[model samples]
Target: MADTFLKEQVRARSIGDWIALPVLIAVIFAAPFFPAVLTSVPNWAILPVSDWVGEGLNWLARDAGVGGVTFADVTRALAAAAEAPIDWLKIVLAEGWVTGAGFNKVQAAPPLSWLGVTLAVALVALRLSGRGLMLLTLVSGLYLALFGLWVLAMTTLASVLLCVVTALVLGLAIGIRAYRSPRTEAFVRAVMNVMQTVPIFSYLLPTLLLFGYGPSAALFATVVYALPPMVHATVLALRSVPQETLELARMTGCSRAQTLWKVELPVAVPRLAIGLNQVVMMTLNMVIIASMIGAGGLGYDVLRALRRLDFGAGFEAGMGIVALAVVLDRLTQAAAHNQSTQAVGLWRRRDTVLALALLIIFTLFSFVIPSLGLWPKDLTLTTAPFWNGAVSFINREFYDPLDAIRTAMLLKVMNPFRDLLLATPWTLIGLLVCFAGYALGGKRAALTVMALLLFIALTGYWEPAMVSVYLTTLAVAIALAIGLPFGIWVSSRPRFHQPVQLVLDTLQTLPTLVYLLPAVMLFRNGDFSALIAVVSYAVAPAVRYGMAGMKHVPSERVEAAAMSGCTPWQTFRFVRLPSAMPTLLLGVNQTVMMALSMLVIAALVGTRELGQEVYTSLTRGEVGPGIVAGLCVACIALIADTLLKSAAARAARHEGDIHA
Candidate 1:
């Protein structure tokens, strides 16, 4: 009876299942006899795609042109335009105005006072949210002032502000266009997927090549990196505007532009604010990464400290970034939620009036009193000594156990998993991926997976790609293992929810570079360290999504399960788990993407993978190879994302069927 039922089920499967099952079985059976194909793609079969791309880019940069103007000229013009505002902002915030050049240079005026900036930030916070957020902003600003990081922090802030503004404007325009046309939206969505997935290093190369390596290159890259989320948010927010409001605008004889500006935009402001928050965070993150190409600010400080093996200095710089990120995040979030009626007059707005007045007063005073402009050097403190001491204590006392754990994990787990992936036939693995994609999403998905995998194989990056896969796979597994259960537990325990959520929020807000500090401090530099860093960065999504999934499970379903004589465990397992599966899968998708992103950064800590390829190419100025490797990483992310999303969709459909 069981055999008969299984056979009937197999026969009833979809066309995708039919194709995938046979391919999977054939690959399984054929692997042993085709031993030569088991390890890697043959050298003769590897394509010179990277070389071709490099040459194409070179031509574009040096020779290609229209109307006798070179591509380089255009890029330089754009870079020049971008640099003007960034330079002006930097001068206003940190550099101060100057006259002349070289030895003839003279300081004409000081930048805004650190005290004034701090008060301005606090007052803005107070206006946006309340006293609580104002206090937080004040503390963050004070940290920058007192830690001697005010200059670097302000420099970073300048770049961030410029990048955010650019991204927001561009994204908003593109998003509105996309919303107006399905074709445009589809194209933009596809481009966004690629843009968001490509490693940040890939962006640096073209910018570097075209812009000739400076803050302009960094600015351009930062804008590109941060623009996608804003575009996505704008489309969503605009789409979500109440249809009745739009109808009302139409009935009131409003033109299309008027309707959008007066009705849709006003209604969408809150959600648009959320997107603004994302753009700011992403801009900050990319700005730090862009530092290598001369974005120079706190990120450069952190990078230099890391290169010098000065953990304390790196920690301090990283913390400065953290403070900036927290302040910005809080301010944006507060702005998003602030819906209080506006005062009629500028003077009636006490918070803004006071903040502006204080800023003006401080600026005037700074002209006579230099100390009022920049915080006093003597008053600033160094926590480097304390951090260095703590690192020393840990190394002295905990080194053995930490080393033991690292060795055990590496020798017993990571190495073995990596070796297995490398040893496995690329053909077989590719087939399996295609099969999964087909089973989950039909023919289009399978083809997409196959093409992406084939590109990686042909580009001669398969081995390192596998290494990336191994590490990411392990990290994501561990992250899910840790996060899912914790998320579940917290979801059930309301008392634990807020604190845990707060921790996750803080973890997410810290720049990716900061995660590396402690990992490098403890594990030094290797795959183990990379794994630790990636895991730390990736775990938050898992916990957040898991908690959301569990919390959203229907109470009625649980009651029904209980009425059917199910125990609490049975109800959770049979009812809640199935219901939450789609969300959990989405969480897995997010976790994988985060791990891939961090893996690129982890290249700094010495992981030999596609990320390293991109990083190496960047250092060597090999645009083609760097881009190819970045594409390979993107391919990996897309594959995981597609498969998981398809699976989630399938699960939802199944659930819908069951409910019906």
Candidate 2:
């Protein structure tokens, strides 16, 4: 009787009881139907279905009474803010660069001869990455010059370099503060999420309002967009430093600043260098989006070419950006990699030598080459004509057929599935997600996903949220198809791993917008087009996580499986995969988050989601709606992340020994 009483006291009845519990998830989502009694609920069909949303968008656009912007007000606000100076020293050292006043500004001198850039970059590359990388820089410079995108690429490079420097300083400053204070650390983390999740378009408006439309606006935007990663990384790196190193500095009676500069900073240098590299890479990732707000350079060229439907011009222009990225990435990455402690003189140091050479060449050219002394006029390489011809041929020969195939896929496969998904009972999705949550994590995970998504519904954007969810599902599915196989193949050979890792790094830095033009050209505007974009962007994480998981799988377990006479397939499937399951889930979580985020960019090809709404609302000056929709995307990402992370944690306890 006592045993029965104890068993009853400790029964897992909440799991069963919660099955009948009212889905308290009305906060993030709305029901399709409700009675007057239930109508009092927050998300009880607040916004109708597709029919109402279409009408609201039309009415909002036509209803000029609610939201509007005046050009004069905007210009006045910008002029006042842009002239605000940092310290006079910083102004002289950094941001005080003056350019021309007209339509075509002479911001900086251009390299006249292809040979100048090649030689300078080759010197840098050779010092950093040796013969092979030097050759790459030279070849990449030639591509820029030969394709007629040299000037535009330089424009983009100048802005990126400016942003990179600014981001590093700001990130280091904030990171230092955050590391010193627990409060600041928490605050920094909160802001990082906002910075990371807020659409780039949303970011541009306030920046434009403050700085006006120029490289300055774009530069600040890029800085703001890229700064958080370095800040977070720096704080983490500093915190991870050995306590004994800090103690030694204290023992020397070093002042706080001296301790930091003399001891802590040196120990943190490698990690700080990594942060600096990330700053550069993230700046590169904002290319075409940065161009949208009036920043000039290769992005502008690509945008103009895209607008003109000149695929060749855009393609070459994009390649110019890629070339520069390749050169910069290799140089920075190589310098970080070999970690040479052999002290060398400043005169012979790789970075110093390269910078000095560039300076000398530029200074000399100012005297000798009239063309290089100023920005070039009539600087057209004219890839446009070829692009135009290709556009015609593709539209006639390839695109139409591709579009037909895409249409068929949509009609036969995607559209119906999307509809079926949208029409699925909200309860069933909640329950299924809840079940997965419980299985992966537990009750808490299920509740978090439920609560976050329900909040999106309460905001009255559930349908577009639904649409976004559908696309996210599709993109992740497709990403898995590509990432999983490549992961398995890469696992077989050690030689392929490093190069594949390098490719993944490049992909991480490759701007999503730059890829959008090509994706649009190939796939056109539709669900399929959007899917391709998401797949390309999201697959890198999947592949990375999968490789990490497999590589970390214990060799002893594999040997045992082999000893049991297991085939390779059986070994991987039954032993390795199960062992790596927890880490694989982590990768899937990232893949899903990335896919959801990319949906906003994918909307350029016409995806109807919170992303599309956020884009449209930002343009329309509907800050409320824009913020709400952006929140929905965030909520969705968080929900999935929480659920997956919870599951991974629970499962990791069992498989936590696996390194990957």
lDDT of 1 by residue, 1-660 (tens): 997996775576665476667768987887867767455698888999999999999999999999999999999999999889989999999989999999999989888898898999887887667788889888988888888999999899999999998999999999999999999999999999999999988999988998888998899999999999999999999999888888889999999999988788877888898889889878878877898989999989888887877778888888788788878888777665654233333223676778888888997898888777887899888888888889889989999999999999999999999998988889989989988897888778899999999999989999999999999999999999999988987899999888898788778867788788878888899999999999999999999998999998999999899889999899888899989999999999999999999999999988999999999999999999999999999999999999999999999988877888
| Window of ten residues with lowest summed lDDT in model 1 | 339-348
lDDT leader: 1
Highest TM-score: give the candidate number: 1
Q: What's the lDDT for all of these models?
A: 0.89, 0.71
TM-score of every candidate relative to the true structure: 0.94, 0.80
Per-residue CA lDDT of candidate 2, range 1-660, in tens? 997985674465455546534444552255556443333324555544333443454344344232365444454455444334322222232223446777866535333344555677787677766789988988887777666666567667767776787788899899999999999999998788657766666666555544566666777778888898889878987887799988988998999999887777677777887788767766776767778876777887777776765667776777777777778877866765555353333126667766667756764575566444333446635566676677567767887678888888789978888887667665556666766666565567777778765666566776787888888988898898899778867887899998999788767766676556656777777778788888899999999998988988889999999999999999988889888888888999989977876788777667888889878875765555665677778877877887778767866766654434
**Residue runs of model 1 more than 4 Å from their true location after superposition:** 1-23, 35-39, 100-106, 339-347, 562-565
